[model samples]
Target: MALRLLLDSADPSAWAEWLPTGLFRGVTTNPTLLRRAAQPCNLEHLAELTARALELGAEELHLQAWGADLLGCGRALAQLAPGRIWVKLPITRAGAAAARALIAEGCPVTFTACYEPAQVLLAVALGADYIAPYLGRISDLGRDGHANLTRMQRIVESVRRVDPDGPGDRPDASPPLRLLVASLRSPNDLALLAAEGLDTFTISPDIATALFAVEPTLAAAAQFERDAEDT
Candidate 1:
């Protein structure tokens, strides 16, 4: 599959800045991001936020469910934009239960906070739409984050071979569980992880900006403009 990028932020300003670029497939948000953006965690605020994201050209929105009643929150988030919303749940027992129920009800689910390779099995078995692993956070724990993420991607690819209509093979079939890697620290991490065969990513605005900050590239663009102006 081709590389898919999602803007990881609750701030509409970020969405407005990047979404219109047509590079990001969507936007991903959790309670912490909402808090960081000074947005309320309640459904009322999320409804407004979702509308704003869509207005800014976000094709999809991954809204995370919080608190004890994950299923309830997932259901509400799913209703926000119907096919456009993908409810995010933690990859825990409770989250699995919630994801199972949500998936059963036809709500696309993304299992989040995935720290171990074994957790990918849960997402696969449950037929989730996506599983997110925090790469930089894993590295912060003194583990080899790139190696662990590659293992997770391998598990995701291995599952595709079992079914005739699995990920990256059939376009009309049910979507397979995708490894949406998150918590990227630098622009270089994109190339590093992509080299490991990982595709989907959720990046912060700073990283997004850095992706276009190469000095040589900027100089080339300036020279092109100067040539055009000279003509």
Candidate 2:
């Protein structure tokens, strides 16, 4: 499968125009993003945004829950988009319990705010659909971000070998839960994670534009055009 590209935008109004550009595979929003949009973080607004994403052909919609009230959040999520939504919760015990419950009930859950490989292992144990690690946040704190992701990948593989029916179960031989690297600061960050075989990466439009703006890339394209004309 192609590496999924999700746009982490705060404004819904911006998405209506941006979705047509064909770069984004999905959209992810948090309470902060909604606050930036000048909207309340309620179920109604979330459902509306989810519907808009669906209309824009987004394959997934990531919605976050801020506190320890996972049951309430899960209920609210069920009401707002149901199967189409991936409820994002922190990588805490409460979050894991809620994620397990939701996933058992067939609701996709994304375990967010992950920092360590242990957190990712817990997410897999809870049958999470996605585990989001903040690469930039980790790197900012003087940690080797890619090393952590690599460690998590190894843990996943080991789990699969020990007990195939355990946290790393491959029901149809599919890989374990996807690792979605978050908190991207630049297009280079996305490229770094993509090269590491990450399942997905969320980026801002500014960074997304930068991915195709490297001077060497432009020069190579220009050289190709000149060579074609000569031929």
Candidate 3:
């Protein structure tokens, strides 16, 4: 499972459509995605969504904590499924504080909204299970998102070498702190980033749809069906 993929969406409809395909390892969501899906950002709603995702075979569900009490929200979110839930927090001071507390409790934490290369250091220090960097958003900021992400990957590997006992170690130990790339605008981003050794990604449903929409593949599949019917 070097190349891991997760559905980056909040809509249950999206989960119902894609999760059964088994193309996605899990799903990731945030406050913005929740609003876009017309869902309230609260523990009650999140709990329901978590149940649905897990029921649909989501091995991991990332739910971002929100509002003033980040720590409180994070704590509650982690309780949704314990080992299966990965509480997402932004790469800010306050978010870091909440993340640190959550990490100490052995909660799976993922640092989201990452833009800079140095932020990987913080994630490594906190022993987060994942750090999500928005690729398209970085490019929107007029920077080379691909290059920035490459650097983040390097830093993660470098730290792993320094501290072999760190995240993503032996199977019996804790899970690795993978770089979960997000905000992908196109399917090609996956290939480009994966080529750079960034294996984990969370793509929107649109991108997931696009991945299966290759004209040649569709034509071949149609031909195969026709041939089978004729025979």
RMSD of each: 1.8, 3.0, 1.5
Best by TM-score: 3
| Candidate 1 least-lDDT 10 residues | 165-174
lDDT of 2 by residue, 126-166 (tens): 77878888888898889998777777767766776788576
TM-score of model 3 vs. true structure? 0.95
- Rank list by TM-score: 3, 1, 2
Relative to the true structure, how large is the alpha-carbon lDDT of every model?
0.92, 0.78, 0.92
State residue 60's C-alpha deviation in candidate 1, in Å: 0.8
- In candidate 3, what are the lDDT values of residues 133-176, reduced to their tens digit? 99999999999999999999999889878887776676666776
* Clashes (N, CA, C under 3 Å) per candidate: 0, 0, 1
User: Of models 1 and 3, which has the larger lDDT?
Assistant: 3
Model 2 stretches astray by more than 4 angstroms: 167-175, 216-231
Of 1 and 3, which scores higher on TM-score? 3
Q: Which ten residues in a row have the lowest lDDT in candidate 3?
A: 167-176
